[model samples]
Target: MTQTKKNQQPQPAAQPKPGSAFAYAPAPESRSVVDIAPSYGLFIDGEFSDAADGRVFKTVSPSSEEVLSEVAQAGEADVDRAVRAARKAFASWSALPGSERAKYLFRIARIVQERSRELAVLESLDNGKPIRETRDADLPLVAAHFFYYAGWADKLAHAGFGPAPRPLGVAGQVIPWNFPLLMLAWKIAPALATGNTVVLKPAETTPLSALFFADICRQAGLPKGVVNILPGYGDAGAALVAHEGVDKVAFTGSTAVGKQIARTVAGGSKKLTLELGGKGANIVFDDAPIDQAVEGIVNGIFFNQGQVCCAGSRLLVQESVADEVLDALKRRLSTLRVGDPLDKNTDIGAINSAEQLARITALAEAGEAEGAERWSPACELPSAGYWFAPTLFTGVTQAHRVAREEIFGPVLSVLTFRTPAEAVEKANNTPYGLSAGIWTEKGSRILSVANQLRAGVVWANTFNKFDPTSPFGGYKESGFGREGGRHGLEAYLDV
Candidate 1:
């Protein structure tokens, strides 16, 4: 482990009393459960095949910088092939009885549950997120999404879109590296439930889980060409989006790329939905419970190394309680563990890539340059692997880039507000409005403040919470269209 800079160093932990059992034993999750192949090919027409140009890329583990596998890099030709396959399968897949489709979805969900442990470990390895999070959060949500959409398979008529909702034929999906499997489930499950065939592209860094999912699809006896997984970079994603055979496009990525995708599909018959970037505000009120609010604040920004699209990167505290909240929040951050993604006890882990770590370091430096006071817990990062400390910036204003831009890191910008109106104003000051968190004990205040917030999803007294039955998206530059619940189905259906 390497020490951080002296000025930004975290305070050392107090020594445990001798012979006391207060210290935690290392409990690293074994990595043997996940078996990586030497090389992987694109899953097209229900079979693995080399890219047309025979190009490939290596996906490395962010935690150890180990090359996990070599995966096919899809090109324009590969994208066209996938779209053609999906187009060919659409008639048969959309013609299937809705209940029959439900059975296939249900089978996939059950298999996901049975292999949950394996998938969780693999995700932790490939994505560099803590095992605790993969085991507890991502995998369960993936399965739940499948099950939730399966239940709606035969019941789309009752979903209120129309008396009879129609499938959109083919869906082209692009998911980000963060929460790779969960994002894939979010895009794929609903499309299949609504009887649309899919050509999905996983982020280049985290393509393993999607390939694993293709195997699951085959195990469930899904028809050939119903689901195709293309592992590639932005060029392939562009090709997929521009393919004429695709009737719908769903993308979860950066706001910049989402805009490009929107333009590519614009003036065409393709339906489009984008779940993009965010700078969510977690507002702490004077009346909120201090300890609970601190935990919520920590979870909001620090979970997944703050790689989340809807992470609460901005913190707004009432002037009356700002001092108390800051003290408690800093103290809590000091105890968080920040190493070894496979460790069951790890609270923070590596950033997803060296490129991402560089971006985070640059932005955090910019925050300091802009005169925001920066602080981080006294945590040692590993000598190898990409890592960034959980950071906080005090004395931030809406004008500060740290408070305004999507840093997309474990860095929070603290701003103080005098009243509820001020808090709402500061929270809604950004162009992105994907989500927001409000901490208060009063129910009426929760309802009143929530109604005024411009974000797509607002939570009272909780942060970063998600459910399959709830709709989630954003207002403004965060991107349009929801991705869960009955609302999610609407994106894949023609009413």
Candidate 2:
């Protein structure tokens, strides 16, 4: 393992016990003017109610480490109730005229727009994305996703689906923390539009926005029980996927969990879609524009603190242009402002939680110990929050742990290739096949390499671009199924 300067502590269990004082948690703060209700419960049958077991968990803010709210901790019984409600509603909701369904979706989209700032602020607070990206990129795209799929609700007959396409009974969706409300929109809009009801579980670390979404459903006058939001830990998610009443399971998270989900759902009648991890390769050819490529590389890995599943963590530069690209990359990275998510000038935000920060710190240390040269801008990280400066490791070989694993932080690993074939070989070296980027002036080369790549999404000289009209997902261990465009509707449709 490469030893990072930040991770040289003795193992906790190995350390001698020290006389310590009483433990105290951070004090909770007054609620933000954000319209959150006290004592949130599971949304079932279009109503919010306590969990069957009456268990609850505290959701905290990554920025200030403040307790934001207490949310229902769902278990098997709650999962069963949610599934039943969705199953019952699916019949009527799906049976409604397609135009009516489209109208419901359109109403939801308008409501989202009306409360865009609130949703974006809440998302940034809960998930720790920069306020700028959450407001400008994530939330808007989330609303747009609904609008795009809204138009398709009445047009499924014209979609590639065969004649008389039908809705799956009930869909259980599990999304990750990196892109909370956006992921919910990705899952729910398409599912509901195709006429399926949804039992959506947002990541435990970032459930606030989804619960807010449940409120939006009420405001939009969506039929009772058509959409439900459950906030809980992993066991709750497991129960949702294994429930026999659910007609489909759609998930976005790590590959290991995705594999387990696949195993759990195997041989079942329920359909499954997984958008798992990615160690995306951002390649820069010698003839590519150096300044633009540097910007692309920064946006690729540094956006969302590199917590994104589609984050381009690997940089494959042609050997001839490697030095120039690295130089420009360093200069560009130096200028990135990292701090409070609420600050309009902040460039990067906090790591989603203490646990995630620990994982990223451990992996970064391993890279240094394994002989990869690590670098970071001289920017000061905030002391009270979970922060990791955007980082890079040069002289990185494919064998290094940092090169192979998904650090899921703002860390980049740069590797050199002699030719385009070598670039492709190194780019596809990891198990993940989510997304990849190519930077070059040569049009034919872009198409040639893109065709040969195994990833589901390919960006030519662009990074982290999203639109409602484009299908997005991953290949191989990155998980299965698509999330956007017309193709996304397939997951909810019965053959």
lDDT of each: 0.93, 0.89
lDDT of 1 by residue, 67-185 (tens): 88899999999999999999999999999989999999999999999999989988998999999999999999999999999999999999999998899998999999999999999
Q: Write the per-residue lDDT of candidate 2 for residues 1-495, one digit (tens) a residue.
A: 111112112223323347632322222221243655546889988898999999999988898787777899999999999998888888899899889999999999999999888888788888888888888999899899999999999999999899789998899999999999899999999998999999999999998899999989999999988998989999999999999898899999989999999999998898999999999999999989889889899999999999989999999999998988998899888788787777666789999999999999999999999999999988888778799999999999999999899999999999999989999999988898999999999999999999988899999989999999999998889988898998998888987
> Which candidate has the highest lDDT of all?
1
Which portions of model 2 miss their true places by more than 4 Å? 1-33
Which ranges of candidate 1 are over 4 A from the true structure?
1-21
- Window of ten residues with lowest summed lDDT in model 1: 1-10
| Residue 169 CA displacement from its true place in model 2, Å | 0.7
Q: How high a TM-score does candidate 2 get?
A: 0.93
Which residue pairs show backbone clashes in model 2?
Answer: 1-370, 2-366, 2-368, 2-369, 2-370, 3-368, 3-369, 4-365
Error of 1 at 129 (Å): 0.2
Question: Least lDDT summed over 10 consecutive residues: which range in candidate 2?
Answer: 1-10
